[model samples]
Target: MKLLFSLTSLFLLICSTALAYDNEPNGFKGLKWGTSIEEFKNVYPNATLQKQQPGEYNPANIITYIVPINESKLSGITITSPFRYSFYNNKLESVLVTFTGKDNYETLNKQKILLNRMSMIYGEINESSGNNIDEFIPGLSTSYYNFNYCWKGTTTTINLNGSYKEPNLSSYLSISISSVEIRKQWLSKVKPIDKTEWSKIRKNIISEYRSDW
Candidate 1:
């Protein structure tokens, strides 16, 4: 009995160590952000910035930023939340943005702070769009749009999108899970997003991004 108990404890210790290592975030090596147009072009050798046409509402047209990761991949960030100041006003608005590249999952995960600000902007849009209070709650109305990142080797494609509802001053937001696919061909080799290990990575990314705010 003593020997059996020792073996069990040893197994548990190994399991715990494996879990901790798996949960740890894989530190990224080649990611950089550019705060200005010239800096962006310097990092992204082929990037170009263009001004918005008169009377056009191109949110990204104002600022130019770039991120270069890996040999043949690039990422960009454009500050598009027009209702940035209404975060404290309890308003509603709409948000639209895009990300592209292979390792963008980490970069996008780091963008949750921006997303929170965009949510505030969405609150403003809902109010200006004349959404009736009876029809929808100000803080409750939110939409999430995302295109799945392609795996290294797979023909299958995954698309993810959802809408969330969180009433004003509420801590918990209700997310409408529109679609989730985890199959052998595509996302099987990649880590599952809902898993606990991925959650830890996500939490760390958000904490780092919001450190200033």
Candidate 2:
């Protein structure tokens, strides 16, 4: 009986791992991870570069593009055109867009409403915590956050964060999507590279990603 139970547990473990890998987010929007820069220019011809030209032949490893729009609305929330596409070594890495200073609500209830809307599409929340009204003192609601939610895939992380700090103040919200494999190598704690293979190791990292959580 013990042997049969052990076999079942192992089978379940393997299935879960396979499911996670299969369902991992491969790309943002229409593009996939490791896409080249040339394709970006060809597809999004109007994407404006947000970098100063390098002094000489050294190419910029980190590049960002800001897509302009008269007005943009995401998830029924009106937003402006400051969406971003950030890349490292000409490969797409992450996308981030922050919305602030709109005619939005000044209450945490609005955030709860938005959270419900997102949960419908993204499924479950991975991990979330925030301060409640009871946790704050008699009058320190400005810094109190009602809630936060995060959804995680095997290789991608999506975060929804932002809130109002005061009455009559703008409620800001930021949504970010990113690749985790790239961030992992960035924060890897391996020993120093060998002098004999310094160039080879550097090339490998330049091609690979080092992401941060």
Cα error, candidate 2, residue 155 (Å): 2.3
Question: lDDT per prediction?
Answer: 0.24, 0.52
By TM-score, the best candidate is 2
Q: Which segments of candidate 1 are over 4 A away from where they belong?
A: 1-45, 48-135, 139-188, 191-194, 211-213
For each candidate in turn, the TM-score is 0.22, 0.61
Q: Which stretches of candidate 2 lie over 4 Å from their true place?
A: 1-24, 51-61, 101-110, 133-140, 144-147, 189-213
Cα RMSDs of all predictions?
Answer: 21.1, 14.3
The digit string of per-residue lDDT tens for model 2 on 1-213 reads 112112221221111111122244677768876777788778778889875322211122457787764487667765544777777767876676655444334334335555677777677777565555334332344542334456666777666654444433334455666666653443243343455655554444434422200
Q: Alpha carbon lDDT of residue 155, candidate 1? A: 17
Model 2 scores worst on lDDT over the 10 consecutive residues at: 10-19
Give lDDT: candidate 2, residue 120.
Answer: 75
RMSD of 1: 21.1
Candidate 2 lDDT score at position 188 = 46
